[model samples]
Target: MLIALFQILDFLLRIVGWVIIGQVIISWLFAFNVLNASSSGVRGFAEALERITAPLYRPIRKILPDFGGIDFSPLVLLLLIQILRMLLGGLAVELTYSDA
Candidate 1:
């Protein structure tokens, strides 16, 4: 049961990490004019990504000092997610081995 819980948590963190990466890539594409924001599909996808990531990013943004136009919130978030995954993974391994 504990192993399963850890797996689910790890999976979720990974998904959120990918979403953050996707958001960054999409933003760069939009900035470079490779993606047309005027198009309905592109606009909708951007909005969806924003909606999904904004909640997670907002608090980090608040704590981070402004760096002109550069955003470091995603990097902070990914680091945090990685730390949590590592802690949880270690705990899960310890639990599995201790049961033997």
Candidate 2:
């Protein structure tokens, strides 16, 4: 059903949001030298996170002007994700009500 599909999408969006948060934290840890990127496990985890987030961040990074070292792509991506979720949720509600 459309509702079930919407639920699945919402869950996925939440998971991706968490992944982005984790990626940001991990990057900070690495930068602060609290986490060693040279370690195999650490490197693997970092690489995986990069792989998951890179696709979403790439286009935003291209459009936004670089601010020296500060990357705003993640924030932009999160905003976009929230907007998509709101649009999908509204669509789901409208569909449900129209069926009544």
Tell me the TM-score of each prediction against the true structure. Answer: 0.95, 0.96
TM-score, candidate 1, is 0.95
Q: 13, model 2: CA deviation in Å?
A: 0.8
Relative to the true structure, how large is the alpha-carbon lDDT of every model? Answer: 0.96, 0.94
Per-residue lDDT for 5-96 in model 2, tens only?
99999999999999999999999999999999889999999999999999999999999997999999998988988999999999999999
Clashing pairs in 2: none
Question: Which candidate number maximizes lDDT?
Answer: 1
The CA lDDT at 73 in model 2 is 94
User: Evaluated with TM-score, which candidate comes out highest?
Assistant: 2
Model 1 ranges off by over 4 Å: none
Candidate 2 residues lying further than 4 Å off, grouped into runs, are none
